[model samples]
Target: MLLKSPWSPRLAGVEGTLCDRLVASLSEDILSGTLSGGDRLPAHRELAWSLGIGTGSVTKAYAVLERQGLIRGIKGRGTFVSVGSARRDALIDLSTNTLPLMLTDKLLSRTLSAISRRIDSDHVNLHPPAVGHDEHRRLLARWLGRQCVEACPEQLILTGSGQQALWLAFDILCGGRGIIVTERIGYSGALALARHRGHPLCAIGMDVEGMCPEDLDRELRDHDSNGRRRLVYVTPTVQNPTTRTMGAARRQAIVDICRRHATPIVEDGVYTLGNDPSLPPLVHLWPEGVFHVSSLSKSLSNGLRLGVLLAPPQGIAQARSALEAIPMTSSPVDYALLEEWVSNGVADSLRDSLRGEALRRNNLARDILKDRPLLTDDSAFHLWWPMPHARAEALAASALERGVSVTAPNAVRTDPEDDESGIRLCLGGPSRAEVERGLSVLAQLTSDG
Candidate 1:
């Protein structure tokens, strides 16, 4: 049936029966390893016409095979058999992916030179201040002030990274047994910290705008049995995995809701910085209630591992106390390097360059996956594509076989219910060649089915 369907020019009268037989035969071929990994199926219409069957029949057959985990699709790309069943060796290493681009050699050389000068200075071995040395603090404060115009230097607190800042915020706002609200498909780090610290995490529904404010208020009101307070964690700007940026109206609504409930919010702005300057940060709007956190790792360099924590004036004392207990002092060298970058405007330059690169990569992605609606922010470094079929596991396995690593949404979730069957393709981590190759493979997969 498979051979006849592929070669026959006219079976018009028995098209329906022939299509049924074709589906069955193809399924056996897939199961038997005849149509292996990276193998492209004929175009849907072409295949249908070739076998003299109605296109709908071929469509239904493909859908059935997909649902049964026999084949996979990548929107604009072609379909292929699941890697494990076909080859068992295709590896796409997208799990825990990093940004595709790296700091230019010139920038790295300049940073190294600055670090050398700092080390050679006589005060190198001295212990830095608890809040951070004045010079470094000033640099960070300036950086933050520039990005969040409404913010002053007094509002900024330097931390080792965004995760540290998150821990500090959570530690200050909620302790053991307190209720915390996060997106249904939230960042895993926050979830893990909540679990280890014995805090209760309530998954809240989220759309493109971000955590649904109505859902959040309801969860808090329902869960606050004794009128006890709760803390809400959100990534409002270029949210991870989903890449959804909350618009102004939605942000205001969220702030209003949180204020009405008197709920403290931890706004993770790690990916928001150095991109669009117009989108006012939650910190800018709700400085008194929002604990804003950002890291240089994503915008500048991951190895720097430096983050800034901006706390509401009222919560400063508690946040500072928490930070002191865990990270009494950040590494001097790292701080010095970051300070040098910020002071000389190197960090800002890198950020600007990265923004352009991100746009380019995003544009490339949009062009490549044009057939699929990509959930992405042009200025952000990642693109989220919902699978036409929920075969993220199979697709990821297939991509991995081709030496392209892509992150499946399943691994990014904290709760099983929060998991979505999609993939996040990062444009910042791999070399341009590698990214192109990986994306090419992904494009093919999505288009096939």
Candidate 2:
């Protein structure tokens, strides 16, 4: 007698074609542990008869499962879950930091369809102004107003991504000659950019409040005496990797230090989206002295790739010129679609949902690692697990061996000589269950001999 498959998913209410839904249901079961590795599945005709679906659909679904390494079949024998499927499914990823899937396929399709209907054929062919289309900029300006950053559309220059915005800022402010100063452990992307461009980078110290004010004041004083142009980049809210937020006093101190030396500050507000605007960004605190760079990649979806550069009045001309100098500008279609989303309140809804998810994941992490020394805020989707240098290395390696992926230690370090060591656990990319499993494995690894 052939072994009957345990598959019984409700197809009456599920979306997608029979085959697609079948594939999705089976995949979910296998990944969720409802279907274990090595469990035998019913033959195509058997499953088709039991599920009341066509045999062809069952065959296609099984073929897809095989391609995904979720199941296998042997000649003259029924299909069975692949022995490695459980391990593959159990391999949790906590390395990427971004909001979960707030932008669903249906929502994106609807938004794109609406944009297509409104935009004319000629408009599609024409290149938008290097600074961005006036309408798009106006919508963005309104969004900025909500964030409490007062700016007209002209000050907001569109870019491909937050990284691109940083590149443009560095090009204009540093001009390949100025020194870049940031916290000892800062955004890896910014640090890598400075190195790639051969710009000198100075690493300052940080405390519980983040970016030690004294260290920054001292560095700026020295660079000022030498007459070296300097750009201070900071992530005030939910600071990357460390997940520390600067207090109002610290923000004022940072602004004062920069102002005293007449240096420009590039405020990375990418992580500030969906966060409390009451704290205000460094740019808002000192608009004339700060260049604010932000994007939708963090708060909504990385695929958005919609970035904005809020340059000070004095640097507007230079920033716009730098943007136009680049051979490519942001996609007009993307901007149009984003404008629709924002106007329709879809963007705001997604942002609010993401904020809620971040809170859920952060709480879960804190609970899982309750006894461990953790550095993270309620709004942050990642946490810092502090440990000795050698121990951090060992912990990361050990966690991987047990099927948990984590960020490498050196990725966020600004100075190789700096002794501070820790691992960054990103909780945004994975599902809640995956996060729980991954964090449980990490907790176990940290407790082991």
Candidate 3:
């Protein structure tokens, strides 16, 4: 008779068969360090009884895990996790910036409980305004206060995602007619959004601090013609694709230049929540001219799909009107759970945990790529690894063959003048050990460069 297993596994979230989900759950648990080497899985019949599934399903799950090098079975003993099996020849992806599962899984039980107590009233409103519910906005405002930013519910426009937030900003502030100025290699999401809106992106030159002020001033002054509205989009802290930030003085200079040319700025502060405390948001400096867009997707959880576009009191009405056509707001269920989390202080704890993990992964990447040209931050979720454009491309291809994934050079390049060299490595996904393994493969490739 097979002995009983001590682990409890469930199949939920994302679509897949029962056996497949079981395999994925086991694999993920091992990678996350929740399950370690020599840990024995339950006997096929025993697990099937516990999970209320067919014994064959459990047997199939075991086979899949064994084939993936996740578990090994002995003739006399039950299946056990192989030694150092979690880091097997699986695809180590450093391309997606996402929160670890363990962190996001903390609030799910509470969220389900809270959501079950609510009653549906969709029949009450045939068409709700895109401004979103007042209660959610109030909660968002309260939460943002912790970040040293102030806003009222009237000035907040809730969006479905950060991408939608950028779209709303472009629609209302820029009107999609004038030239949009941005850093030479800026956030990939913002670049795609601008391109989709058919706006000309004037990619400015940059330094270590990001987005050169002199280049921005020239771009603004040169395009100050025919009464065309010019908009400057920037990510000042923990910038994506480059992982660099602008100092206070550099930020002030950019704001001053925008003011001189009367050009409005859309400050993408999505990546600043986990950044240094000393760096203040640009909206604090010039609220009227800055359209600040941020989201819980980065800080809390990506699947939440909740973002806020906070405008100054003077511009809130117009911003609200622009979203009227699209109705780009968060859903009732999403907002309710996010509010519950915020009210109970779960969001803050989650943010802190995520920041800690990001730092750990960043350190691992630093160690692997030691003495190489790296652009990184202690709090940021990703880094910039610079190499010759051609070499970067070749190395990226090689990395793919070695089962490592990374962002290519052209994906984040803002302009033709920008060098095609370098690739952005996201250090947020997977575990610290997994990130280190991926970076080791990349380190060998970097040695050639």
Candidate 4:
């Protein structure tokens, strides 16, 4: 008699069927500690034959497990159980996650074609200069100039990634003893960087429009009395954690304030692309005082690690000098690949696809969280939901118990005293089915009286 299988029918293909069973079996084994951490699994063909399935099925199963973090596949070596699989029992990773919607095989094929064309011309590994290849820089600068018409290509500088650009800006502009004003709840990366550099972080208040102008003024005034200058950092478009976008009026007010005080605003517009085109960047409004940072990671593949920094005309030389002091140059191969993608319109296609996927996930969240109070912008990739009964950590822990991972507010806060009770759920990180199931699990946990 054939053995009864506990796998789901939703996974259909031969490989999917085999993978489903293997994942089910492996999940149980891992949880039971039978397949302990660092234990290697049998070879693909070996496992397939033993399980009475095709080798392709075994491969697919392994891929599923790898994506789920149950296993880690070494390039040459065999696959082994992940170290933290057991410890991840009660953690839902709704934090620091992203998913690509437009990474279609067609787009991949086109990108590969473009890359192959470049490789055929023998332009793969040649490092052009510290800044970047002139062609790539011009292309990117042209694109940015069109996006934010106020700034020209002369003001833009290329970096390896958005985080790197931010670091460079901090180092060049807000050196020793300066105050960096940020939102009470903001991107933790900026906060961590500030703390690491030993700069004082003045947490300012924010409203639906983003940083309150009055609070910004107050912080500036307070810092002025202390004989220190202040630099402001903000993510005006689709602000992380809160998923709130700053409007035009607020943008004008911020620009006006920066101009008046000569305060430099490092505006993170990483997520601004692939959204509604009408949302103008602050850099466009306050070109003299605003420093703009953006990246292609969220829209395209994160592996590229390409970022563009647009500084004021006067600050460009200083910014480039600071960047050279740290990471002098980014990988040429990555830049070439990114430039090829951008030239072929593959990047834009991917952005559109990712945006649509984010919308669908947001819709799913709306349906599941209909009764619950959640903060989300239609254009953002993540949502912020407050748990009524449990603290953010408790809720995250509870969700993790059900095999879902999420990030609590505390994980993203610079100060422990900051609000410790909300969670940021990334709609882009997991597969759609996985997100649906995960959100269902979360809804159950949060709904429990």
lDDT score for candidate 2 against the true structure: 0.78
**Candidates' RMSD to native:** 13.7, 12.0, 11.6, 11.4
Q: What TM-score do all the candidates reach, one by one? A: 0.73, 0.77, 0.76, 0.75
Using TM-score as the measure, what is the rank order of every candidate, best first? 2, 3, 4, 1
lDDT for 165 (candidate 1): 79
TM-score winner, 1 or 2:
2
Model-by-model lDDT, in order? 0.68, 0.78, 0.75, 0.69
Residue 61 lDDT in candidate 1? 66
Q: Which candidate number maximizes TM-score?
A: 2
Q: Sort every candidate by lDDT, greatest first.
A: 2, 3, 4, 1
The window of 10 residues in a row where model 2 has the poorest summed lDDT is 8-17
Alpha-carbon runs more than 4 Å astray in model 3: 1-89, 104-106, 118-126, 223-227
TM-score between candidate 4 and the true structure: 0.75
Which digits, one per residue and each the tens of the lDDT, describe model 4 over residues 309-378? 8888788778766756665445666666667766777666766676777788899999987787888876
Better of 1 and 2 by lDDT: 2
- Which segments of candidate 2 are over 4 A away from where they belong? 1-90, 120-123, 223-228
Off by over 4 Å in 4: 1-92, 104-106, 119-127, 145-150, 387-390
Model 3 lDDT at residue 299: 76
> Per-residue lDDT for 1-449 in model 1, tens only?
33222323332211113443455556545544556755667768988777777788788767756765667776877666667656433333334435554677887787788688655353366755445666666667766666664555566677788878787778778866676788876665676677767876777887878789889878766665464447889988888767888888888888888888788899988884444566778877777899888777777776877777778787777766665666644566787777777778777777777778888888888877788868988777777776523477578656644455565444445455644547777777666655677788887876765
